[model samples]
Structures are given as structure tokens and as C-alpha cells.
Target: MNSLIRYQVEDGLALITLARPPVNALGQTLRAAVLDACQRAASDASVRAIILHGDGKLFSAGADISEFGSAASFAAPSLPDLLSRLTQLDKPLIAALSGLALGGGLELALACGYRIGEPSLRLGLPEISLGLLPGAGGTQRLPRLIGVAPALDMMISGLPIDANRALELGLLDRLAASADTLVEAARAFALDLLGDLAPARPQTPFAEPAASVAEDFFQQYRQTHEPRWKNRLAPRLVLAAVEAACVLPLQAGLERELALFKQAEDSAQSAALRHLFFAEREAGRIPGIAEDIALRPVARVAVIGAGTMGGGIAMNFANAGIPVVVLEQKSEALERGLANVRRNYESSVSRGKLNAEQLEQRMQLLVGTLDYADIADADLVIEAVFEKLEIKQQVFRTLDEVCKPGAILASNTSSLDVDAIAAVTRRPQDVIGLHFFSPANVMRLLEVVRARETAPDVLATTLRLAKRIGKVAVVSGVCFGFIGNRMLEPYNREAHRLVLEGATPARVDGVLTDLGLNMGALTMTDLAGIDVNFLVRDSNRSAFADDASYYRVGDALYSLGRYGQKTGRGFYLYEGRQRRDDDEVVALAERLASELQVERRLIGDAEIHDRCLFMLINEGIQLLDEGIALRAGDIDLVWTNGYGFPAWVGGPLHYAEQLGLDKVLDGIHRYRDSLGTYGQRWFQPAPLLERLVAAGKTRIEKI
Candidate 1:
């Protein structure tokens, strides 16, 4: 027997265990071993039945993702071929599942005659997330087993269902009463099947389609999901593959699934999604931080300030079941902050996302106070106070004086220098930037800024804590605005400049929305508050080039007290959450153009898309060359998670690579030549981009 496979026979049952430690990822070598084991069990007269299980924890996570796009992935017996052979076995085959059975793992389970799982089982075909449908008979076999609608939901959403839900959906034959008894239960179940002389049951036979599934069911699913699925190829192809199962025979359906899988695999959208799948995992690994580094225990957390950002930051800890103390300067502010947290929880309860008991339990974990001494024992202190540098430094000094030894000191400054804040602390090694986005509790991204003197353990601990709080944390070197916001400066500059040169706010935003961003740049500014953004720009005024027309319209709006959604006016007028274009804003832009001697002309959607996105991409390359971002993918993660960059086009850097580095370079030169001084100053191509283009390299990570 192969070392990767543990084969044994007991009581006339051949037990085949996949012994790949960690996730039992199905690779070529493991696939070959599994095939040999199954063939051996089928031929042996003494083995009346066979049971397949993984060595530990999980049945399998899926195929070896690292082997994807490599020649090894297609080496026979491929997953589809091996599964096809499994269905032909004369003896009954049973899959005993535990933990996760995802993608190819669940597809393997579906090929078995019967599947019995532990109560901890989680099953799904999540290939759609990587921009590809399941290639190994999943699309065809699943719909036949579970019917069309449920199978479509499972494949398209790429979300896992628990053991109870799987059992209820008829995806599992039976679940073991407890996780510890899974193997024993499977053995007994196999014995019972052998005693009854049961024939091998395959999922090839299809019953009549579900009554709810109409002839136009797939079309309706597409129409309803098109907005979310726009620019995404895999989800639409998944729908096609599932529809094939309903009309075609088993063999024909499997062939159609394979064809669709190959098509999706070759698409740029899938390639981008696959790149991101690896990038998100790679973002966690720091060069100097070893995997075994001891992490600080964060039993209690403290937040300074009682404003919206502070309250939201506190809720994150409370929701994660950690005790949190929120400090405010006055009694009234502290009460209001605590009340806001309650309202947020109450809103969750209303949405059926949290129960009444959960709401009270989370709220109970939050304690509001007015004294810094009250948070002296906190393991982690995050100051979400005012954005001023002096204010943050003062808060850090107080935290350094009061907090216990080994406590982490974090600042929630979006664009300020983390090193400057750390310089005020006695324990600079403990100081780090935990820049959470607005509505901190709701945003998925967390930028972890590491100062020059930051210890490896401190960085590692913050990354671990970020995961615990359900945030996609990306480590960034210290710089003004860090990763996300620093790149945003150039992107926003072009949007503001485009409006001055002729584009309206609505048109500028519409072009971006059409390109698949969550919203347009102008709309995002309005949502973030024009006055707030103007203030941020003013604080960083030294960084901007000497241009008279730079964001002048925004400055004008701020002067007019047009503060956006909160005030119902800014770049556009707001009616509640809905917004409409304002002719006055356009008039203001034209007036600025005339006073600043800037020529306003017809701006097409193409220029609007290219100028904003390409500048963003250029700034990202500059960040990469400057070492503010460790890898190109880290920059991509920051944009996709934090700034609403579409995943289908990948992040800006990856999208640039897809569009060809040479073309991006050419676009920069073209803008520089046409826009004269303004373009020459801002559109200068980064050295890294120029070098990559000269070298004819398509991948940004080559450096």
C-alpha cells in the first residue's frame, strides 16, 4: 500500500484511510493511491464492504489548490475519472466524513454508495468562489441527488452547510451521533449494509424534477442574481452546468460539466479569483514572524473615545465575546456611546442576525467609563480618539503610563504617522496601528501598520487577534495613509480633476459603477462626507503637488457647508439615502475651471475609467517599489477588502497585469503628453511599472 494511504481489513471490511496530514488535498499522487486502494478492495473476496475516511479532523478541504494551473493537476487518474471508476465498483462503498468535505472532497463523497458523517461535518462545493465550477461530477451528481434548486443554491453560493442541514437536504445518508464515534458508526453501518446484501447505490438515477422548478427557473435565477454576478463568469456557468444535469443523461451531464469547468478555468475572471484566493492566504505570512511565535493573550480590550468609530470598534470586541472598556472624556458622551452600541445590537436582532439573548450578552460585555485608570488592566488598548497627531500622542502617553506591562497600544488613525504615535510611548515595541475603516464593526478590512521598531511578536499577535475578530488583516510598513488610503489619494485626485476638466459627478461615478466597483469615486466621497475628506486632505497638504486646481471643487463644497448625506448636500443632493445630481455642483466645477485657468472639455466614459483606475494602479506600483507594501498581492487585498475594488478584475495591480503592463505604461505617457503640466506631475509612471513593461513581464510579482 502507498504510504499516503493506510489500508487495512477488519471483519470482512476494507478500510481505506487518506493519511495526508493537515487538509487531505487531493493531488495526483494521492488520487492514484486512492484509486489503487479502491480497486484492491473491490477485487478482494474477503472484503465484503469498504469504508473510506481521512486520517484526522477533516475528510478533505478540497483539491490541492497549490497544484492548480499546473500539469500535475491533470495527471491521471483525474478526479472525474477516479470518481467515475468508484461508481462502477461491485462492492458497496461508504464515505465516513468529519469536519469539512468541500469542493472535490464533497464530490468524492457523492460518488460513494452511501455517505455517513459525524455531527461536525460541513459539506459544500465551493469551487465557484475560485471562479470555477466543480470539475469532478459535482454539478451533475449533486442536482440528481438533492434536486435542482437546492443544488443550484449550494454550488452558486459556495457556502458550506452543517451536518444537520446536509442530512435534512438528503445530502448525507446518516450522521453519527457524536464526532468521537464516527468511525465505529461507519463500520457498523457498513456491516448492516453487507448483512442486508444491498446493491451498490449510485447517484446516476434521476427522479422527476422538483415541482417548483419551472422551465424558466435557470433564467429567473440569472435575472435575479445578475447584478451581484456581473463580470463574474463562474456563477453563470455553474447555473448552466446544473441545468444540464436536469436534461442530459448522467454521462452526458458529466461531460457537459467538464466542458463548462474547462471554459471557466480558462477565463480571466477565474484566473483573477484564483489569484486572490492565494493572495488572501499569503497576506498573513510576515517575513520575520515565525509561525511558532507566542501571541499575546487579549482577554480584555479598551477603546478611547465615545464617538461613532469608537463605539463600532468596541462592538467588534464585545461581539467576539471579549470584555471591552470604552473610555470617554465626559459622562454624557460615554452614555451616548454605550447607547449607540445597544442600538446597533438591537438592529442586528431586528434583522434576525442576532437573537434577543445574544444582543444582551454582547452588550453586557461592553463597559463605558470616563477614567483611563479603569482600563489599566486591558491586554490591548486601541485609541479611536481625534485624528490629530498631538491628541493621539497624548492618548498613547496616558496608555503607556496606565496599562499593564506587555499590553499592545494601538491607534485607529487612518492617515497619520504610526511611528510618530509610537515615539510618544515608553514601549515603542508594543505600539502599532490598527486602522479600522469607518463603521468599523461592519467593514471587513483591517490595515495593521507596523512601525520600524515593532517587534515580530507584536505584529504576529495583532494578525492573530484580527482573525479572531473576523477581519481580513494585511500587514503594512509605516507610511502616511498606509496601504489603502495612500493609494486612494491618486485615484481620488484623478476623479476630482476629471470633474474640473468636464465630467459631471454622476458621469464620473457611472463609469466606475459600470466597471464593477461597488460605487463611483464621487459617490464614495459624498458617502464619506465632503467636509471630512477635505479636512483629511488639508491635514496632508504638504504631500500634494503644487496645483491650483487640485480638489478645489471639494474645498468649495466644504466652504458651503455641504457635508454630504448627514447634511443632505455635497457633490449631490441627498433625499434620505438616495441621491440626485445637483446643477449647482456642476456650476461650481465650471466656475473653478474658469478661475483656475483649466480648460474644460468633453470627457468620455473611457477616459473617466482609465484615468481613475490606471492612476490608482500606478500609485499601487509606487507603493510596491517603496516597500510600504510587502507584495503586490498585499496591495490588491487592501483595495479589494477595504476600498471596494471588484474581485472579478482582481485588484488594481492584478487588473493592470491582465490589461498588460505595457498598455498601462503607454496610457500614463499618453495622459502626460495630453494633460501637459498636470499630467506630467501626477501621471509619471512608477519605476517598477516602467521596468516591468521594458522587460515584457505580465505578472506584477516578478520583482
Candidate 2:
């Protein structure tokens, strides 16, 4: 096989270019080739210096994360081994970075004698996100070059810093004017280094922070970030590695980092997080869509509401530099929506996330009007209206009449059947569902609900547009609530049942929090408003006709006008955002249990956690078997991104696969036998689940 690294000689300099396609990931093959190239350069009599860069768009997007946990990761000329050799090279080595120098890529740059990068280059060590530390020399070398604080901040957060910030922090030696000039600049830098003829610094004994100060920062970081890092091992492990760098010698610190990296790589958390990372990427791929399918143009966008969801949706387009026309029936509503959008932009400006000029440019892209004609020229029209079926149909009818031919019409409905809405349009293929989560601009998840009649090009175009607007779009077949909310229904149902069966809302929430969820079920319910769920249940009465007790606690709370935090009471009492257990809600549950002659019993934490999680998992299986979800991982992406399902758990279906399908089936059987009718009604094993268990498959992929 040809080498992934290209070696050439020019002007007494060995030029090594990483020639891997796409993002130039540092896999075993690339590493070996790089090492061989370096060896060739070192042995060449004519070569005075070496200049390293990458072909195509990026220097590197970091290590080939797909190789994690595989034997190839530890193959000869491993990243650490190559970096060490580069550091010890007798000839000066210069790195020319253009696009991204992340994780192992940044470590490779740091190992060289001199580093020059394009001004727009993105650099960081983001292994913390995959539940691992930088296994090479990142943990040891970065602090030595840029000081302890900045290095710690970058590693702990896993966020990339721009080249300018990198230069300011001393991470980069110099910045070229543009990517086109990076190589020549690096060549000049290497020649300048040869003229100076200074001996290369030995890579060891990295700089350390004051012992007392380092201790304080780690402690403070753990305390402040503990909630976000709940049930996660990598952040703490990363901190430990960084601390070792502060206290130990370079080799010792690297050894400590390697040990921690191995531990994290083997961890369940790392496996789950890595699964989610791949799942998110897999969500965009449509199995049947042709690779060469032409995508519809979506230059002008229009939104058919000015409420919270509408305003947020409009902001996404405006942020992407696409002009948006927001239409409402009343001018007052339109004005309120425009004001909300302005306030959101101003808040971003206040946080230094955006400047006044950026805010103005974004706001300028938003056009609010009361006339439908204003939006006729829009290529995409999304209706973020109320969740009622009639309202959605009426909006679609109007959109069909007013929207120009080929205009993509979408609904941000959470529960209503998307096909029914599409049925009202003259061009059903143009109708799709772009279900953005609440605070659409901030949240990354967007469920692209593909209707039965939705054209391949429409699906392809919407998925592409979602990326342009900074959204993680997952394709979902037409179904009630699509993927996220459909699975969420069962989870919410079981949460209410658990409370009614004598578990406190706080206890249930606490268990879920411990299990790695950002918030507990009841806590999320309260935040979302109890009446919202009650309204959904009311609208879908036929689906729950067999079980009157379904979501009963929520309905009762809503009946009493205890809407949620906005009303100061629902599942729990809230006093100025502080939630406290309330006697009245508990009494209401007790009364309902007595009326139905349903004996209430104390529920353990494990039971509450399992019942809620398993039911959600069961629903996801049903979605998979019924073809509502394209793949198990896509369902995982929906939950992890849209529903706050812990990424560390790898979403519901993956979690079930990890738990063993046989074990999951056994639990469902046990629940069916114990709960009698209720269990039989809800715990029916999916055909796919039963078949997979029988086949002894441990992963959804095998199924």
C-alpha cells in the first residue's frame, strides 16, 4: 500500500505532508508512515531541516477515534512513539498547521522544534469529550509550553481555541497570513532555526504550577463542574493527569496520563460516549437515499409563528446568514416575537459570544410581517404553531396556497402526525417535519421527520440545511412524536406510576440523576409544566383509553391549576426556583391509589430507575421494529441530544444492548407477571428484542 504520508526533499529540507483524506486522522497506518518519513529525513545527508504539514483542508482532526479500544491503537510507531522521536530529531522539525490540530494532532505539533499555523487554524486537546485524556504528550507538553492554567482550561473543557488565542497563550510560535502560505512560512521558519543553530530542548521535566495553587484549582474545578461531570470518569481522570504534570517529571506524568487513558478507554462511560459520538454521525445517513440525489435549494426561509419556538427557529436561520420571514396573524404577536429575538441576540452580545455588529447583522436577516405574500418567495416555510391537529392542517393548507412551488413546508409539532399535516398540502413531497427542541438556536438536536411522501431530495436538503444552521439532525420516519418524544411518553408514564406507588418525586429524580441523567423525570416535568403533558394526554385520549391511570398524577396536578414552576407547584413545590417536597401532591397520589383500590408500596431506587429506563428502551425497540427509527443508534442520538438522556449511557437502545437483550427480556417478563394487567399492557417484548435475545446478540447492530 502507498504511504499515507508523502515524503519529498526541497532546498535541503525534507517536506513531510500528511496525505490522508477528509480530516487526516492519525490512525496506525498514518503514524507508521510519518515515522518512516521522519527516519528517512534524519538519515538523508542532504536534508538540513524538516517541514511537516497536511494536504487538503485540515492539518488533522486529531487521533482516529474509531481506533480506540482496538489493538491497532497500540501498534508500532504509536502516536506517543512518533511524537517522542520527533522531539529528539537532530534536525529542526517545523509543523505547518492549517485547519484543525486537535488531540493527537496538536500533540504532534507541540513535539516539533517550531510550530507555525494559519491564523484561522483550530487547535485543542478534546479527548475529554470521549472520556479519555490525551494519551500521547498533550498532558505533559502543553503546560510546559503555555503554562499550567491555560492548558488545564483547554483540556478540562475539551473546547478548541482559535489560532489567535493560541498565539496569545504561546501555544503557537507564529501564525501565517492564510492556509496557502503556511508551508512556505514554515519552511522559512525552519531555515531561520537552522541559521540560529540552537540545540533542541530535551522533552522532559515539564513546567509545574505552585503545589498549593494547583491543589486549589483542581479542587475548585471538581466542585464547580461535578454536576456536569456526574457519572463521568474522564474529566476527573484528565484533572489527575494534568496534576501529575504539575508535580511529576515529564516521563512520569506521561506514564500517569497513559495509565489514566487506558483506564478511561476501558471504562463503560467511555464506551457509551464513543458510541453516542458515532451514533450522532450515523443519524444523518439515509439508507435508501441516492448519494447523487440533488438537494433542493433553501436560500430564503419563513416561519409561521412568533412564539418561543418560532422565534428560536428563526434565530437559527438568521445566525446561518439566511434571510428569514416570520409571519403571524396579529401584528402584536409578530412584534413580541421580534422583540424576543432581539433580546436573545442582545443576551448573546452581553456574554461576549457575539459583538454589536454580529448582533445587528443577525437581526437584520430577520423580517417580521403579517402578510402571507411576504413569505411566498421563501424556499422553506416552517410552521411552529400549537400542537393541535386542526391548527397544523389549517396552517399547512395556507402554506400550500401561499408558498411557491418546491418550497419545503415543515411543522415543528412535537406529537401530531406529520403525514396528516402533509396530506393537506398540494405538494406532499415538500412537506417534512423539522422538530427543533425548545430554545432551538441553542439546542443542537433537530428531528427531520420524513413523511411517507417526502421526496429523497427534500430529506437530503433538510439534513444538509440542519448542519448549516448548527443542528444535529436525525432522520425519523413518520410517527407520533417522531423519535425523542415517542420514547419519552413511556418514560413519563412510568415516572408518574412510580410516584403513585409511594415513591417521592424527589427520590425518583435523585435516582435518575445518580444514573447520569442531567435531570430526573419529575424535575424535567415540572420545568416543562405539568399542564403541557396533561394537554398532550388529553389530545391523545384514544391512545390511553385502556389505561385511565396513565399520567394521572400529572392530570390531577394540572386540574388543580398546579401547572409547574410557573405556578409554584406541580410534582413538587417551588419557591423562587428551589424545589421542595410538598405534602399535598403526595396526599393526592395516596387518595388516587385508595380510590382505585391499588395498594401503594415503597419502591426502591433500582426499581424506579429500571422501570423508567426499561420502558423507554422497550418503546425504542418498538420504534425500531416498526421502522419508525432508521437504526438503534439514531434513536440513541435523538434521546442523547434532544431528551437529555445521558451521553455516557449511550442512549436507550445501546444501553439495553449493553445490559444484554436476554436480561432485558427477563426483566420485562418479570414485570409482566408481577404487575398483571398493567405489566402485560406495557411490558410486551418487541419482536426484534425477543429475536435478538434468542439469537444471543448483545448489540443492536448485530440485530
Candidate 3:
């Protein structure tokens, strides 16, 4: 491996460059060498000022994720040790940040007396996403420098802010034209800091209220907000750190922050969250993919439908500056879809994410047509028709007749045999799937389904396009809902089964909500239209009234005309569009339970969360066993990005590790005993699960 740190002193300034390619992730050797360099700079008599910078694509992509779950000591002075040394040195310290300065990178920048960055630099402290708080001086120094409110917002949300925004907020002292020139600007800035009036650490106490920012900000915000935190770990833990900084001295505050950080890093919640993060990136890979598969650039795209999903898919292409030709079945639906597109653009303009001119530019990029002839010039054609296989076949047949040679044909099918859809055309190699979640324009996930006949280049082009549209492309093997919804079937099945086993819809929903899913499976069904899942389920003999042990509570709700938020009703009733708990629904569940002669027990909240989640983990293992998913990490990504699994929990596999596989298998067996034979297949442990159970392994990748 290449060395990460190098130090040089000249012209009264010392420069320390983190030279790790890609990102200077704090791996074993880098950690030790960087700390050694920091010490050398501190001891050098000729060094008047210090500058820390990174080489290659980014400042750093935080800690080397590969080093996670290991007990390797930092092998260098701790962040606190280095930071405290920086402050005491007679020389000023300047941090030159470029690209992304995230996690430990942000913490490192906070320790410096000054920060300068390129206009494109993206800065963030995203420990919250990993189930930890900043363990370095960030918790103590950031609030004091930037005020508590903004710091709390940045810390809690973990969203990266662009450099211009950082400059406005005083997170950066100046901006450069490009990332490569940042070091030159930092050298100049450091020279300016070489005087009696050089920049000094702020002496203000953390509690000194900025008339505009104070404790009341959080107090007031929480009052009007429903307790929406998925769990008490991240949000509450972060708030406590911020408060400690407000009152304690810097040394004590840092100590307090470190203690909290340790607690979280070792916590099951943090482990789960970390697993989810790795799982998402893992989703991008496919087994047996040739490294030579070349991605063709997609400058123009065409869509064959104009429903909500179609319109949204069109928006993705147009918004990314790819010209679009939307082909609908009729002029009226085309007109309606085009009108909705305009409304969406105007709404975004109103919200200031776009300007009037930009909206016009995006609209200019989009075109609507009623004829298949318009698609001949497109680089790609996506079929976003209804979920019926016949409809997709007809669209593919039309595209086969009309599209230019080598044009990639794709389907936005959530669940259906994509290979069968590809078979409708002579050029099956050009066809693939890009399964966007509901409200396609808003969700950050895209399931890139790969059929066996699909050309690698076509799959590669689709993956690149997915990233361009701001979606995480998790490559998936063909199955119902591919990886995400396929695993979700068993999960949703169990939730419905619980209702008949004595739990109510409310109880099940609450348990999931508490566990950190965006909503309970039942409520999510309501939002997605209670009938939508049936479209997925009705395929492949898994539909309701089947002898399979599958359960779908929403099926009954839909049969009763409760079609979710759009119909103003679902598993729960709604007042107008607002969801309200329904006593009638609860009473109906009771009636069904009575007819089944089932016993209702006082199930604890933790048990409900674990049981529902473990079912998915079991299926994830099976998917891996069947090679529907390449790895455990791929399944994790599917759950994290598409299924609203909490990011900090790391994903289902990581969460299972924290719970211990033996414990999870034990629970599955317990549930099997009560749920019966169908439960045996649905809840049975995978071979890997069995191995982990036998070995008593608490986490994967530790060995």
C-alpha cells in the first residue's frame, strides 16, 4: 500500500499532505503516519505556520470503512491530542479542504485555526448517520464557532453543505476556484496569518447566546414537532453533547463528547447504522460482470407512459439535462402529464431549489409526443407503463420496431418478470430495468434490475444514468420487487400475521415506526395505495387466498375500499388527507382474531421490532443463498436506500449482528412454533445464518 502522509517545511510554513488516492481514509498506516507528521510539524523550529491538505479526489471519505469492526488502535496521537497541540503551537494552522471534507475530515478542519476551500468543496460531519457523534474537538468547538442552532442542524441531519454555503456561515474563511489550487490559496492565507494579529481561536464561551441563536431554538422546535425521532439514540445523544459544549470548558466538553461517542460506537444502534451504509454501496455490484463493460453516454431519453411514475421518471432525465421525448398512449394523458411536469417545476421554483430561468431550461430539455416515431433518435427508451406484463410487452414491441439501433430499452417495473418483458423484442440484450420507488422524483433509490440476456454495456449505462439523476443504483436480480420488495414481502407478511395473532394494526405500525422505519409496513401500504402491493403479490402464485403462509393485511383493507392516502382511508382512517387511528379497524382485527381462536399477549415493543426485522434478515440470507443478491451487503443497501431502514443502524444484516445471529434464529424458531409450517419456510435460517449461529459471531467482517 502507498503511504498516506508526507511533510515538508519551506518559507516558514510546513505542509502535510494526505496522499491516499481516491480518499485519504484514516486506515491503519495513514493514521499513524499522519499523527507522526503532525508531531514533526509541531517540533520544527523553522515552521511558522502549518497547512494540512489532501491529494486526489477528496479531502477524505472519513475513516476507512474497511477498518470498521476492528480493534486496531489509531496507532497515532488521538484527534484530541493533535488538536490541542495545534492550538498551543506558536504558529497559526490552516486547513486546505477540497471536494468532500466529511466525518473525520470535518473534525480535522474544525481543529485548525482557519479553513480555506474550493467553491466545489462539500463539508459535513456525518457521525450521526453512523450512530455516533463527533468524538474529536468538533462537539466542543463547532457550536462555539458557528452557534448551536446551525451546528445542531448540520450534526443531526448529516447533509453536506456546499462550500459557498459554508463560506456564508463562516465555516470557511475563503474559497478558491478549483480543488487543486486550494493549497496555493491556503499558503497565501497562511502567510497572512503570520503576524501578531493572526487569527485566534474564539474565546467566547459556548453558552454566550448569539442574540439570534440560543437554547430556546431547540426547545421551541421540539414543542410544535411530533416526537418524530425514529429512536432516542442519535438525536438525544447529539443534543446532550451540544448542551455540554454550551456550559463546559473546552477540555471537559471534549472529554464528555468522547465518552458519549464511545458509548454509541460500541452500541448496537451504531453497528446497525454502519452496516446500512456499507450495504448501499455494495448494492452497485453484480457477480460475473466483466470489468470491460463500457457505459454508453445517455444524452437523450424517451419514456412510453405518462402516469405519475412515468412523469417522475421523465423529470429525472430532464432535470439531469438529458433531453426527453415522452410518448403517451393518448394526447389527453400526454397533456395531463406535461401539465403536471410544469406544476412540479413551478413548485420547485417557488421553493427556490430552481429559478425561473433554470425551470425553463429543464422544460426545454423535455418533449412530449404521441407517436413512437419520435423515439427513433433517443439514446434510451424507458417503459413506465402499468404493472401488467402484457402492457410492457406491447411497449417493448413498439420500441423494437421504432427505436434506433443500439438504443437501450428499459422498464420501470417494480415487480414482474423483466426477462419476459425483454423477450418481447428481438434485441433483448438492449433491455434492462430501472425500478424507481413511488414518488419517483423524490425518492433517492433506484433498483437497476438486470435480466440474464441484458448486455453488460446496457446495464452499465443504466447504472451511470441512475447516479446522474441523484439516485443510488442498487443492481438487483429479477424477482418480485427485485431485492427490496421481495424481502419486504416476508416482512409485511409477518406484520399482517401479527394482527391475527392478537396484535392490532396500530400496535404493529407503532412497533416499526419505533424501530426507525419511515412508517410501519401497514401505514406505508396505505400511503402506497393498499391495492399497489396486490399488483406485486398477484404474480407468481404468491397472491392472496393461496395456501402459502404469506399474509397481507392491506389486501383486506383494499377489499373494503380503503385505498390509502389518495382515497382518504387505509389501514387507518383519514380525516380529509390526515391519517387518524380507526377504532373500527381495531375492532375488525379483534373480530378476525376471535374467529381464528388466537390468543393475544402483551408483546413488548422491542420484541415486535425484532420479530418483524428478523423475518427480513432471514429472507435476505435466502436471497444470498439463491444468488438473487450477491452479498449480505447488497441486501443491506436495498433496505437502507429503498425501504427507509435507518441509516445509522447500518442495515438489516448489521442490525442482526448487533442482536447476535443465534438470538435472531432463536426468535425465528419461537415464532415458527406459533405461526406453523408456513412460518418454517418464511422464518427458516439460511446456511450463513446457521454458520454464524454455530460460531456465535456477533458481527461480519470482524475476522
Task: List TM-scores for all candidates, in order.
Answer: 0.97, 0.97, 0.89
Q: On residues 1-703, what C-alpha lDDT tens digit does candidate 3 reach at each position?
A: 2367778888988999899877887666776677677667778888878898888767877766655455642335655565666676556778899898988788878878788999888998888877778777777777887778788889888888999999888888889878777888998888877755675454533345234365476677566442776464866778888777777877898889988877877777777766666666666566666656778768889988988989999998888888999888799999999899889999999998899999999999889998888889899888998889998898899889998899999999988899999998999999999888878888888888889898988887787678789998877788776888888887887777777666777888888876677888888887787777665676755443544323435556768887888788777877776778877776666666666555556666766776788888887877776677777777777787778887666678777776778888888888777656556546667777777677767754322
Q: Which lDDT values do the candidates have, in the order given?
A: 0.90, 0.87, 0.78
lDDT digits (tens) for residues 201-260 of candidate 1: 844434544433888887788889988876788988998888888788889989999999
Worst 10 residues of 2 by lDDT: 203-212
Cα distance off (Å), candidate 1, residue 122: 1.3
In the range 435-540, model 2's lDDT, one tens digit per residue, is 9999888999999999989989999999999999999998888877788888888899989988888998889999988878878989898888888888877887
Candidate 3: misplaced stretches above 4 Å? 1-3, 35-45, 177-181, 195-212, 215-218, 221-226, 541-556, 586-611, 675-703
lDDT of 3 at 540: 51
How big is the positional error of residue 465 in model 2, measured in Å on the Cα after superposition? 0.8
RMSD to truth, every model? 1.8, 1.7, 3.5
How accurate locally is residue 529 in candidate 1, as Cα lDDT from 0 to 100? 89
How would you order the candidates by lDDT, starting with the best?
A: 1, 2, 3
Clashes of 2: 0
